[model samples]
Target: MSDSKHRHKSVLKKTDEELLTDDLTHQLALHTRQGHNKFLSESIIPLMLCFACPFFVRSIVFICDHCHGSIHEFLQRLLFDHTLTLKDVLENFFFFKWHWPSAIIIIGFLIYAIIMTMLLPGDEYQGPITDTGHIPIYRNNGFCYYIVSLIIFTILTVVLKLNNLSPTYIYDQWDAFLSTVSTFAFLLCFCVMIKGKYMPSTNDHRSSSNWLTDFYRGVELYPRIFNIDVKLITNCRYGMLSWALLSVIFCMKTFELYGYTDSALITCILTLVYLTKFFWWESGYMKTIDIIVDRAGFYLCWGCLVWVSGIYTLPCYFLVTHPKQLGFQLTILILTLGLLSIYINYDCDRQKIQVRSTHGKCLIWGKPAKIIRAKYRLLNGKESESILLASGYWVLSRHFHYIPELALAFLWTCPCGFQYILPYFYVIILFILLMHRAHRDDQRCRLKYGDAWIKYCDLTPWKVWPKIY
Candidate 1:
């Protein structure tokens, strides 16, 4: 092969050590190996391209269709010729055309969730100790809010269809959803910037004091609005519930366009079951890294608002047009495998929680929960105990949970079929996300646990996949 081709291949095959470095540009460059053939096949690249790549695709196609152009010219057209002007952005902001319905949707859902949270009876559960040496007591009412959201979604879908209007109105209001979600993000960031008086003591660390980064990372550790937990509402209600709601809309749209198929039903059922499982384990979720460890910054807030509700449901959206008629037997097989994966994933988590809660007095696979008492230091440099599990699914691999979770994601989208690559976008992105998350978690434990973490690793003998990574 030519030297240039050899160099390109070498660049693509950068050492895992290089990828593990804290270099954003280098990571971005490596991810570019996943070029424009398809989205889902590219692994982690789809997460970024899902926003920018597809939007420019239509314009690129239009330009190519109208004018003959070489590959270089096409790429140049994609970058230089397709810039979004301020006027177009402003026009999308207005509620005149397609924006009004989605704007109403934004307001209606926000008010309903907020009001439901206020009216619903809630208890308090103190979270893990914060970096600033405080355990935050969060109001726990996500279950009730989950029920209310289901009711609202069902009512709206029925009411709209009964009035000869389409229940899948959201599919046509993509622009509206974008504009409103952006508006929410803008207002919330602004509000967070000005909420100095409301800042939690847990957020005393300003890191570098860079306003842009801090704002993006968030100023408050846990910001509440008038006695309501903002994180629960934004992350759980808005992001998670909106995910389910959008899936429902996509299901309706598919039925409207093409009669119900096993593929569509499977997609809808997997989505609904997964989301319902989320609420069923709402309290268990509160203890997760997103709620306890991560900041409520743009990465989390805007991500949940925009990315989670929109791109997360791409499989269902793709299935709307490319409906797969996977026969009944295939559908059942896919679902059975998917549910088994979900159960394994859930059981892994349950085992860990049980070990921690019972102080290693729990059973794993009909035997005692094998655990090592790992001593760790908190952000405040104080000592704490972390029960490092060595039993159950964890005994198979350090991150065996993620393996099955990825499987669950794949099986969930199997109905989308293999004809087009778009439907498996979630599966690819999720695997990459989980792998990255696992690495982060590993680094975090290494720092916090020090020698204890090293010992735990020695005992476990894996980071994610055993004997591979």
Candidate 2:
């Protein structure tokens, strides 16, 4: 064989660690990595919300006396009115109070969740390779942890009433609990940033040179502490698990205060079903943008810790006090639509998983699946192939799954009725988030797959909504 051909063969056979240390291959990897921008979004906005969200929930949703007015009028009085002052804002919106009991419970529960994750038996799944040649090994025990935790919590709160702990504890302490979770988010972000800088788990990390950027965007792709995956604990266990628990907690609160309101019950049940769907398909999520591309920084870590805990449950929280009848017909209509959206969303994910797992050999919608075998080169100069799904819901839009996701959010929020827009905040935020994610995913794929991605886009036309987006 020729000397050049022999050298290429040797390079291809090198281990991932050796390939990463090779200077030429490392340089090739850098060329494929995408750049991060939008400094205002990455830094300032999230910081402001980190402090502001709790205040909004407490003052506006929990204690606001201006519900009699229209949302426009409420905003006008709060923001545009000349009568507004710093004193009023401080007194109403920025009051800080600490409740040690609630704070301790919140902290203890997080630690307990970590313990559960460590002890739980889970299937092992390997994530995609990173630019630095590290592939994350995740323990897919989320569904197990979720079910076990719920059972334990139900026994403690409802069945046994251990230590006088009731399901309504979170509801009764909502004000202080919100503050505690938010504070934890801030602290968690700071600790994660420090750890990423000094004690990253692997070579798949870098400093942005700017501390603020490093803090906002995260320093590491995959971070671990004491052999525990930080994102798995924060994102899956702490964030998503809290979202599910709070839904039931809010439902319990509604039952305690008012009778069993159909609206609140429907919202809570549907939200649980959707979250159950999440845990079921979580392995797919580990490969998506949130886990794959985003680093262990404030945007992700703090979001899972705080935003998922607080904002994701806003509709249920709003319904705790503001129960609605919705009657029989309306309830049936909303329930049917909500359940259908959940199934479609689940099916969309299933289709892609099916095609990828079977190498496009499976039938989609009773026909042979269509796929694009997008070819690319890894940092080692070795060619690789990725399947770009084009069958089932994927044929409708590049991110057709997101459409059903947004619909599910709206359906759950619908129980709150149109009397106030506060409960619909989740729907609005989800739309914006999913839209941005769809765009970001496209850009990431384009950078990774180049011409093959372009061909896939040519075949799929729609970005998210068919013939509209």
Best by lDDT: 2
lDDT of 1 by residue, 204-252 (tens): 3333234555455565657776766667778887888988888888888
lDDT of 2 by residue, 1-469 (tens): 5985576556656654554446554433342232334466556765676566656655554332344414666667667884656677676556655679878878898899889988899889888777556788988888888889889987777554546557687777776777677677767878888898888899777775567777777888789999888888888888998999999988888888898799999999898999899998888988888887788887898788777877888888888767889999999999999999999999999999999899999999999999999765555566667899988899899999998899989999988888778778789988999999888788667656767778889989899999998
- Model 2: lDDT equals 0.79
Model 2: weakest 10-residue lDDT segment is 27-36
Candidate 1 residue 343 Cα shift, in angstroms, is 1.0
Clashing pairs in 1: none
Report the lDDT of model 2 for residue 2. 100
Per-residue lDDT value at 271 in model 2:
89
